[model samples]
Target: MSRNPSPCLVPVSHANGMDLNAQLVLDQKPIRQQQKLRTLTKYIQSYPSGWKKRFELAKLLYQIGQWQQAIDELSYVVRRQPQVIEARLLLGHLWHLTGKEKNAICLYEQTLAWVQDDATRYHITGLIAQCQRRWQTALDSFESAVLKHPDNSVHWLLLGQIQLRLEKPLAAQRSFDRVLSLKPNDVTALIYSYDALLQLHQVKTAEQRLQQAYKNAPSDFRVLLRLASRRCQQHLVLDDERAATLELIRTVLRLAPQSAEAHHLLACCHVFQGERIAGEAVMQRFVEQYPNHPYGWYFYARLLFQLGQVQKAADTIMHCYQKQECDREIYRACCEILPAAGRLKLLQPMLLEMVAAFPMSWSLWVTVGRVWVEKFNNYELGIAHSTRATELAQDQAAAWFAHGRVLMLAEHYAQAIEALEQGYSLGNAGARLQTIAAGWLEECDRHI
Candidate 1:
């Protein structure tokens, strides 16, 4: 009759030494979460959510870009619950969207360290590497990420970009292939593939691919710029094409006025259009705009040389050389426009003096050979000079071209063809030079 001794569902003690439920002691998280959820639900149900709502408060403040308040609430939540990856992720993204890249990167790295998922970690690592100019590292990171998130086309596109920077076209092609497979309408991958194919000299295939890419990515500036670069590489002197190139450059300038390479390329394109004055103006603007840029003085002097401003060009280039001018490219460019005429004899001698002072200068040797051999048409001396130049500048097409011209003039047609063909492969081949070399080759073939 003792009421069957009521079942003991509680612990032996409580706040008042009374029985308490044992379940609460073991499962505290559910109780806290339930309380929080109930409070949140009550505030949400009542429209404005009042002071009981922390998450909605943070969200609302964030929507209005009241970042300080949102940051305070978010920071509080993170402090209260350090395991909330989503909150950290959103804050990191917000920091980046607000242009606080350094802070964003710090937070992202922290979030990535906490994130257990391999795919997400890979993505964050890739982004961080890319932002730091660690391109090879980025490539490796993206490759692993793509393996984890095979369906992520964005990762594939980014991987292709890293490959392109590293100049691994075959690897790049595979990355782009995956991007296209996942998202057939992706413009970036298609355009990049078109450019990579063109570099391989698969002209027909590149043309078809570019046309299709352009159709899909009609308004893409990169596609247009790349196609324009192809036109330049073709080196046509078409008036209409030149105009189009100029227009494309104008459009690019409008979009990105500070792009140094864009300005330089457009200025070079002007030479083909017979707009030398306009070209000079654009190049001058480039110099003014990018005085610290390496190519500015180089292209400026080149334009000046083409316009017959020999002394000024030499003097301008000399100034640049005085300021850490160990750039082989700058030396080569200077040689192209140093004006090796009777009036400029002293300049050539001065350059020869430079060559004497720096015997390792393949460019100076190439210049020496051009003056002694090709331009003066002194066959034995030219051959000797050219042979010396070739010894120093083995892979230079200009040296080969000058040497081949000397050979052709000396009736060494077979040797001339061989040298000229080598020059063509190395990019000293122009329409005028090609016509001459082809004529010499034909003559040699006839004798054979």
Candidate 2:
């Protein structure tokens, strides 16, 4: 009466655990796997207390990329057998993969409460901190992990990635080098080390590392995307080199159709090829597909700006801002596009929001001051923001320049001169600022 011939054949009950695992590993056919899954379900229905069978089922679901189903089984195992730390860890990882970072962190924290092993504790702590973007905490935890287990390449790799995020490129390079020493030609380490090398100004060495990454993992989407992006940077013109870069980007897109970086690179390739319409279309589709992706919207707006659709660009930026995607690039684009399109009034409310969002952004404060003074003639607000900028970054010439500009706009010539002089005194640190300050000083002198 039944179509499935192996309904009663559960590997769990009849076969040894070793044979069950071996069968799961060796059977590559989907139909056979489905049959096994059905048999396992029936076995579990008969014996609801079979945590081992459930865990194995979860693992099999994970292998087949049925993440949600895997998570359900893992959660069931954890709820029933609270001592199963393995199930909890896998469940946390699945939560992270599903973009439930807070849930993952909560689960990891619970595991930390009962976890006794020093290395594992540190590793879990690092994962929690990494999810929260607490770079220093992650760095400390990963540092302890590497210290406790110097031979662990994964530990070194994590430590290096945190160092890179912290902008310690030299230290990151050393950590990545350790990972390479432990596991040579590791594509992840090689790709990540290329970033460190670039930050260290070791451009030639960076290229070599990237080349090695390509050699090690030609099919890896990250490697392919990185290779294409690097080529795009070096070959900006529409020549043979640029065409080759385009081909590389096409390959990356083929491999990873949903990759944001690949889509952006393809758009850039179109721009380089002088196909502005094609570039615009690509970015438009990208933003449509990934509306929550800030960079995609940012680039789409930028393309709109380049295409002479100033009003449309401003509208795009405003929409992005309203969506609460307060990325620095979006702010920069807003600053550029808004004033050019006479939409500074629209930027005013967003400026206050940006200040609250990024209170420590000295450049943003400078822009805030400039906008208030230039657009609204509100020198009081301008000077307040400019003063805050200078207070936040006392050594930054741009901040001092912004302060001077606001003061001059307020007709406080003497105070403006003093601030400009301070900015000019910073020399090479503010070389361009010095020229602007000198001109403003001459203007102030004439007024005084």
Candidate 3:
């Protein structure tokens, strides 16, 4: 379900463990192979005599996400050749994945009987303990795996992932370091390593890791999104990161041809990039594909309004709002998009309908205050709504700001000063809001 790449395991072609070759013994340490010893085992069930082929097939099936089939194949191999430790080890893992926790632990125990290689046994032992949620035992198992096969980057990374999950930051970082030393271009290890570094506030070091990651896998979405989110010391405004992120998302769009979320991210990027039209081109496809999605209506409307296409924008909102399945978010969105007038004629009718449909939402109350104060100039109606906004929000700053602004317009100078002071204290009033309040406060001061 994670469409994004795991910072560790990016999509490897063939879904077979990356580029496995004869060097697996040297590379991954397949030294526990028992081809001759396997043939000597007593067959308790009907299965092929060659345990290695069975192990390979099981691994292949697991790689393809056929956990059940892999379990079946490995179970067959293990039943006949009880001495095939690798087959039993994988069967334990399959059982764990299949939600058979006790069964998985039993397979690991059985595997331990045949596996003399301390490293393989430790690895299986760790995994079984992991299934049991005995994390400390899992640590002991992976630590043993490292002792036996110190050069196995995969084992090192697995250790790091577990350490990270357990919140052992220093230990996790050390494991990632070993993993990186073995496979210098290992992106996943590097990413997790950066995370550990970031948590320690070793930001400059973490940044260097990010740069290293970008150098290694420039097209990877994990790196790009991290960059977009600007995960580090100084928080950059979302607007500042928009241009590069928008372009990065466009590349993702090229890779994933039909992702509404990707399209939505692009639209958000456009909001900051100041390229409303280019962003809209992407949203148009998402809108067409997922018409029922409220965000589809939400985004396209914002873009159209920003593009000065107010009529079209209004029509889009109306289409979503009138539907039976529409969410309350549509009302909030309407409140958000309404302030972008020159679209008021289009906004007004729709807002009236929304107010009628759901009168109690805080958003609708806010909209009513804004509309009466700004558009209708009906000071009395504005005060009524503004009062409600204040009451609903427990007289919070923005509510008070709205209430004060309406009071100034209605010439209730005494109350306006109190409300404005409350708004100013909360740091909620905008410059325009302050200006109006200031003028009224000064008038009251003079009268006093």
Candidate 4:
């Protein structure tokens, strides 16, 4: 027994009657993790068949965000012991996290064959379908899982989410109700039930659910934001209600000091109270704090626009675009601000990128077409984009009008007249649009 010491144990001589447990308790997480990894590596090398040690190492890697390394170790463990359901499940989860959702689905499906427990089998089946975005399949699998294990609140939550995605709000409401019954005051269930109730037009019930969520999770920023938004939307006759709503939003800002959403909400509250200057100051502070947040700049730009500082608003939009932090809203704002500030040609590239990202958005296509035809005099490019817009939204008067305008620019008089007529007949086209279409149609007829 005295011949060799175990590699896994701390040396007893160095212990010196001291408490190793107390020493471990004082050590930092990284130090403790290093010690564990060394011990596990030694054990794994000493025993080649030690799949348990490999699994432990994989979990440690996962905890430290070494996802690819964790996947490697998990791959080994699963290969060595294919029946290890937990390892297989974790491996699938890692694959999903790494954006290899198809791989996760395949692995989970294979593991389903080995899962003997009805609940686990159904759960894994549900996970496979979820990874594929096959909501119906996931719904069926989670429904069976809930039937097999009715007490699992998590399973019920998943079922409810699937039903929501599938647009079966009534079924989602029932599933979320089960989750609430199992764990009363469940914030997720409360929030989701509120959504379901809203979809079902049960306004009173949804209000009650939102109140319950706020009551249960007053400190939660999401609940506070929701409550504050509802209060802001209502016509506040009472000073007390308006003050309370403003205070709720302030609390959110205090909790999440750098949250762009909280800052935006605070600025909007000020604007709602007819305090545009104060709202501008709040948005300025937000952009200063979160210079990289695209929405922060967007909110600031919008405030500047409302204050009649069109040039400054256009500048802010340019800054956001230069940072390569763009989304649909940012692009749309660019299209508006640049044109209003007499920088219409500056929007050409942004419009192209926006259309690529949102190809099905007829408004974006129309914007692209307008820029190309009006600013760059590229009628061919304009016609191509406007044609795609009309194809994507045949019923949209705006889309048809845009197509007709592009055709008129390209000197396709007959096609331009036909498109303008179609748009004028749509009736719901705005007065400005109909007037412009009529003028353009007359111009095209004169040319022909």
Candidate 3: RMSD to truth: 14.5
Sort by TM-score, best first.
Answer: 2, 4, 1, 3
Q: What are the lDDT figures for the candidates, one per model?
A: 0.62, 0.76, 0.64, 0.76
Which stretch of 10 consecutive residues in model 4 shows the poorest summed lDDT? 18-27
Q: Which tens-of-lDDT digit does each residue in 1-448 have in candidate 4?
A: 2111111111111112211100001112556777888898888889878888899989877655566888999999999999999899989988866557878988998898888899888889899988876666888999999999999998999999887665456678999999999998887789889887765556678889999987776666666767776676574514667777778888876655655666767777777778888988998987775565566787788778877899999999888777653566788788778988989668766776887776556667777787777777888888888898888767557668878888888788999999988876766465556777889988998999
Q: Residue 149 in model 1: shift from native, Å?
A: 1.4
Tens digits of per-residue lDDT, candidate 1, 1-448, equal 2111111112222222222121111112334544655665567568542332665556545544455666666666666666677677657655544445676688778777678889878888887776565766778899999999899998888888887665455567778888889877666678888866653445677677788777775445565566666667687437667677777666655544555455766877877678888878897887675565455676677667777887777766765555443355566555555544233553455555555554554445655555555445556765665666667555556556667766666667788778878877876334555676667667767765
Give the per-residue lDDT digits (tens) of candidate 3, residues 1-448: 3122222121211221121111000112122223322342333134546666667766755654456766887887788788866677678766765557788888787677777777877888788878877776888889989989999887898899887665455678899999999888777788889887765446678779988988877766556655554521132325565455656666656644444445666665655557677778877877777555555676677667667776677677767665433455676566556555455665566655665554444445666666767676777776787787667554245556657766766667788888878867865344555676677678766754
Best by TM-score: 2
Candidate 2 Cα outliers beyond 4 Å, as residue runs: 1-65, 84-86, 306-308, 324-448
lDDT of 2 at 131: 77
What TM-score would candidate 1 get against the native?
0.50
After TM-score superposition, the amount by which residue 234's alpha carbon in candidate 1 deviates from its true location, in angstroms, is 2.3
Question: How does each model score on TM-score?
Answer: 0.50, 0.67, 0.45, 0.51
